[model samples]
Target: MVVALVGNPNTGKSTLFNALCGARARTGNFPGVTVEKKVGRLKLPTLGPSRSGGGGAAEVIDLPGTYSLSPRSADEMVSVDVLLGDAYGTPRPDAVVCVVDASNLHRNLYLVSQVLELGLPVVVALNMGDVARARGTTIDAGVLSEKLGVPVIPTEAHRRRGLEELKTAIVAAASGPALQPVRSLPDAVVAEANALEGWLSEHGCPDVPAYLRERMVLDVGGQVVERYRTRCTGDLPAHLGEVRSRLAEAGCRVPAVEAAGRYAWAREVLDGAVETTPEPAATGSDRLDRILTHRVWGLLAFAALMFAVFQAIFSWAGPFMDAIGEGQGWLSGLVQSAMPPGAFRSLIIDGVIAGVGGVLVFLPQIVILFLAIAILEDCGYMARAAFLMDRLMSRLGLSGKSFVPLMSSFACAVPGVMATRVIENRRDRMVTILVAPLMSCSARLPVYLLLIGAFVPATAYLGGWVTLQGLVLFAMTSLGAVVAIPVAWLLRKTWFKGETPPFVMELPPYRWPSPRNVALRVYDRGKAFVTRAGTLIFAASVLIWAAGYFPGDHTELHAVQAKMENPQVAADMSAEAWDALEERRRKLSADLIADSALGRTGRFIEPAVKPLGWDWKIGVGALASFPAREVIIATLGTIYSLGGDVDETDDGLRDAMRRSEWPDGDPVYTLPVALSVMVFFALCAQCAATLMVIKRETNSWRWPIFTFVYMTGLAYVAALLTYQIGSRLF
Candidate 1:
C-alpha cells in the first residue's frame, strides 16, 4: 500500500515522517527543494503478515508542504497533482495522511477539507497537540474525527507520542474503503465543475477528476490550466473563459469564491471541536516576535547574528583544521616512506593527499555554517530574517521569498539555486538564481582563509573587539553580497523586467531547535561536501597531478638530494653548506614545475590575468579552480609544494609565497595582489556545479552561460580596480 503525507508549511509533518521512517527515508528533488518529495518504507508492527504474501511495509511518500491544494504556482501545483494522481511517475496513493497543527486548527482544517474532497482514505494526524494544550487551547479529537468522518489521532511528533496509534489508523484506513468528502460545494459551482469535467473528457483529456476540473475552472490563470491546455486540443482557453464567466454570474468568482467557501466550511468544522482557555497576557511567540520581527531591532539582530556566525566559522574551526593538516602530513610521510622515489610516490603524497586534504580541512567550518543555518531555520528566526530583508530586497526587484535562497547561497550555491523554487514569480526566481553565487559560499572560505592568513595582519581593530583580519574577511564576503544587489537590479531592468511580487509568509512560533534535525542537516551537508571532494575534486586533483608530474625529468632534483644526503660531505661541511645544498634541491624542484605541462598552461594564460596582479603560478591555480572554487586552495598548495619542496601546510604555503619573487627579483605576492585575488574569486562563478544547477533550475543553458560571462567580467574589473588603487596607495 502507498500512503501520502501532506500538510501546511511549519506543521510537524516532516517530523512525523522522520519518526515513522527513521533512516529508511530518501530525499530528492522532484524538481527542487520547495517541491521535493521524500519516500520511505513504513513498517507496521500490528499488521504482521501481508494478505498479498508480501512484507507488511507500506510505501510512504512525504509530499511538499503546502497551504492548500489550490494551484497558484508550479510548486503548489505539484502537491495537487501528486494528490490527485495526475503527476507522471506517481500513482494515486492508497491512503492520505493529512497532518495538521492543532493550535491553529481552524486554518489547518482548511487544507484537510480540501484533501477530504479528493476521495481518498485520509487519517488526520493532529500534530503539536502538546503545544496546543500548553497554550490553553483544547482540541476534542474525537469530535473532530466524527465531524470530519475520518480517523483523527493526536500526535506529538517530536516526542514520538501517539505514533503507533497513528500508524494503526493509517493501516486500517488503507485496508478499508476510501472516505468521501462530507461537505458539498454550492449547486451552481458543482454544475459548472460537472460541465467542465464532461468537456475535458470529450476533448481527449480523459481521467480528469471533478475536483481538478473545478480547480482548473476556478484557478483560470494557474499552472493547472496552463498545464492542461498543452494536452487537449482546440479552443481550451476560450472554453475556460466561458465556464469562468458562467460561474461568476452564479456568484462564483475565480479564487475569491473558492477561498471563501472552503474557509467557511473549515470554520464550521472547528466551531464545536476546538475550545480556548484564557490565560497569560501574551504568548512567548508574540513577545519574541516584537523584538525578532521589529523593523529596526530585527535588522540589527540579524547583522549581529551573522557577524557572530562568521566569526565562529573562522575561529572555532581552527584547531580541527590544524589537526586535519597534521594528520594529512603524517599520512603523506607514511606514503612517501612506503613508495619508491618516483612520479608515482609524488602522485600519492602530493597529488592525492595534498590536493584532497586541502579541501577536507575546511569541512569543520562548513559543518558549523550548516549547523548555524539549521538552528536559525528550526527556531524560526530565518523567516523573520527574510521578513526584515524583504523591504531591501524589494528595491532590487525581489520578494522576501528570494531572501532564503540568497541567504542559503552562503553555505553553497547548488542548494541555494534549488531553494529559489519558493519564489512564485519566474522573473524574480531567475534573477535570484543568477545572483545567488555572489553570496560568498563556503567553497570560497578556504581561499579567503589562505589568502588572509598569508597577507593580512591579525591585529584587532574597532576598539579591539574584532580582529582586523576577521573584519577584512567579513568585508570581503560583504562586498560579494553587495554586488548581487546591483546585478539583480540591472538584470530586472533589462532582461527580466516585471513587477516584484508582494512577500507573504507564515512565521511559525519559535521553538527549540530539534537536535535530530540539526544533526541530520549537518551530516547531510558534510556528506555532500565530502562526496564532491572524493568525486569531482578528486578527479581534478589527479588530472592536475598528472599534468604537473609528467613530461619532465627529476634527474637533477635526485642528484641534488643525493649530494645533500652524502654523510662524508655533510660531516665535513658547515651548517650553511648543508642549507645551501637543500636550497639548490628546492630550486631544482621549482625548475621542474616551471617546465611541466601545468606550468606551460599557466604561462599561456599569464597575459590575460596580469592586470589582476597575478603571475603564471596564480593563473595556474585560478584555471585549475574553474571546476571547483575551493580546489584553488589545493591547487595553490600543489604549486607552492613543488616550489619550496615543502609539505602542503598553511604555514609552509604562506612562507613559500612570502619568499616568491618575479623575474626582476621583486616580491610577487604582495598585500594588494592577495586582496585582488581574493576579490576575483569572491566575484567569479568558479564552481561548475553551481552553473549546472542554474541551468537545471532555469531549464536553459542560456541563463547559466550569461551568469558565467557577467560574473567573470565583474570579477575581472573588480580585481583590476582593487589591485591598481591599492598598489598605488599602499
Candidate 2:
C-alpha cells in the first residue's frame, strides 16, 4: 500500500517524515518535474498482514510543502496528480497523512479542508503540540476527529512523540473507507459544479473527479480549468466564464468564494474543539524577533552570522583537508611503488587518483558549508534572513523568497537552482535560476585560493584584522554576487519583466536545530559531492590525462625518465652529469607535452585567453575544467608535470605557476594575471552539472543555453577588462 504526506511549510512535516522513515528514505525527482520526490518504506507493525496483500510495509511519498491544493504551475500540479493517482509511475495513494501545525489550527485547516475534498481516507497528524501548549492552547483530538470524520493523532516529530500512534493511525485510516467530499460551498456553487462535471462527461473529457470539477468551477483561471479547456473543445472558456459569473451573482465569487467557504467550514468544525488562554504581551519568540528582525540591527546580525559561517567553513575544514591531502599523497606513493613505471601507472597516479582526490579534498569545506546552512534553516534563522533580504530584493523586482536560493548558491549552484522550486512566481524563479550560478560556489573556492595564495602578497592591515590575501579572497568570493545584481536586474527588465510580489513567509518559532536532520542533510550533500568527484571529475581527469599524454611519441621521454629514476645510472655520473641528465629529462617531458593533442588545443586557444593575461597552459586548464570547475586544479597539476595529487595548498603546484614563463621569458603569472583568472572563474558558468540542473529545473534547453552563453560572455568581458586595466596600473 502507498500513502502520501502533505503539509504546509514549517509544519514539521519533514521532521515527521524523517521520524517515520529514517534511513529507509530515498530522494529523487518526480517524473517530468524538478520537484524533489522523497519516498520511504513505512513499517506498519499494527497490521500483521499487508492490507494490499504485500509485505507489512507501506510506501510513503512525501509531497512538497504547500499552502493549498491549488496549482499555478506544472510543478505545483505534481502534488494534485499524485493525490489523484494520475501522476505517471506513481500508484494512487491508499491514504493521505495531512500534517498540520497545532499552534495555527485555523490557517492549517484551510489545507485540511482541501485534503478532505480529495475523497481519500486521511489521518491528521497535528504536529508541534508542544508549541501549541506553550502558548496555552489545548486541542481536543477526540472532538477534532469526530468533527473531521477521521483519526487525529497529536505528534511532536522532533521529539519522536506520538509517532507510534501516528503510524497506527495511518494503517487504520488506509484500511477504512474514503471520506465523502466536503460540501463547503453554497448550493448555487455546488449546482454549477455538478452541472459542469456532467457536461465534461458528455464531452470528450470523461472521468473528471467531482473534487476537480468543483475546483475548476471555483478556481476560475486555475490549472484544472486550463487543463480541461484543452481536452474539451467548443466554448469551454466561455462556459467557464458564465459559470463563474453565475456563482458571483449567487453571492459566491470564483476564487474568493472558495477561500471564504472553506475557511468558514474550517471555523465551524474547529469551534469548541480548540481552547486558548489570552496571549502574553510578548512571547520569547516575539521578543527575539524584535531584535533579530530589526531593519538595521537585523542586517548587521545577518552579516555577522554569515561571516562566522564562512569563516568556520574555511578554517574548521583545514585539518580535515590536510588529512585528505596527506592520504592522497600516501596512496599515490604506494601506487607508484607497486605498479610498473608506465602508462597504467601514470593513469592511476596522475589521472584517476589526482583527478578525484583534488576535488575530494574540498569535501570538508562542503560539509561544513552544508552543515551551517542546514542548521540555520532548521533553527528558523534562514526565514528571517530572507525577510531581511526582501527589501533589497524588491528593488530588483524579486521577492525575499529568491534570496534563500541565491544564498544557497554559495555552496553549490545545482541545489541552489533546485531550491528555486520553493518560489511560486515563475518570473522570480527563472530570474533567480539564471543569476544563481553567478554566486561563487565551492567549486570556485579552489581556484580562488590557488590564485590568491600563489600570487597575492600576504600583507596584513587593520592590526591583522584583514590581510591582503584575505582581502583578495573576500573580493573574489564577492565578485560574482556583486555582478549578479545587475544581471538579475537585466533579466527582470528584459525577459522576466514583472512586478515584485509582496513576500510573505512564516517565521517558525526559534528552536535548537535537530541534530539528526542536520546530520542527514550534511551527509546527503557530502555524498553528492563525493559522487560527482568520483564520476564526472574522475572521467574528465582521465580524458585530460590522455589528451596531454598521447597523440605524440613519448618513447624518448620515457627512456629519459627511466634513466633519471635509475639510482645506479645516477651514481655512475658525476654531480654535473647527474644535473645534466635531470635537465634533459625535464626538457623531454616538456617537449613531449608541447607536441601533444592537449598542448595543441591549448595553443589554439592561447590567443583567445592572452587578452586575459593567461598562457597556453592556463588556457588548457580552463578548457579542461569546463566539465567541472574544480578539475582545473588537477588539470594544472598534470600540465605542470606535478601528479594529480597536488592541491591548491601544495607548494609544488604554486611554485610551478610562479616559475612559469612565456616564449619571451617574461613571467606568465603575475598579480594582474592572478586577479584576472580569479575574476574569470568567479563569474564563469564553468560547471556542466549546474547547467544541466538549470535545464532540468526549467524543463527547457533554451534557458540553460541562454544561461551558458550570457554568463560565459560576461566572464570573458570581465576578465578582459580586469587584465587590461591592471596591466597598466600595477
Best by TM-score: 2
On the 0 to 100 scale, the lDDT of residue 206 in model 1 is: 81
| Candidate 1 residue-wise lDDT, 1-730, digit = tens | 7789999888878778878887777655454333556788898655543332334678898887878887776667877878888667777787899999988888888788789888888999999887787788888899989888899999988788999999888777777766766554676777887878767878879888888777787776777788788888767889989887887887878768877887788888888998888673577999999987888888888888867876776678778888998999899878865655677777888778876785576577768777887788778787787788889889898877787677767766766776675565667888899899999987787788888988988898778899988988998888878888889999999998756756777888788988887776677667655664335555656776787766789977766655665668779988998778766766666667667887788899899888888999898887767767866665665566434333324687888789989899999898899999999999998876677567655656788789999999999999999999999988
lDDT of each: 0.78, 0.82
Question: For this target, which candidate reaches the highest lDDT against the unseen true structure?
Answer: 2
List the lowest-lDDT window of 10 residues for candidate 2. 528-537
Tell me the spans in candidate 2 whose CA falls farther than 4 Å from its real position: 46-51, 73-75, 198-205, 225-239, 404-430, 441-477, 493-499, 528-534, 563-581, 610-615, 627-678, 688-706, 721-730
| Model 2's TM-score against the true structure | 0.87
RMSD values for the candidates in order, in angstroms, are 4.8, 4.0
Model 1 is weakest, by summed lDDT over 10 consecutive residues, at: 46-55
lDDT of 2 at 374: 81
Clashes of 2: 0
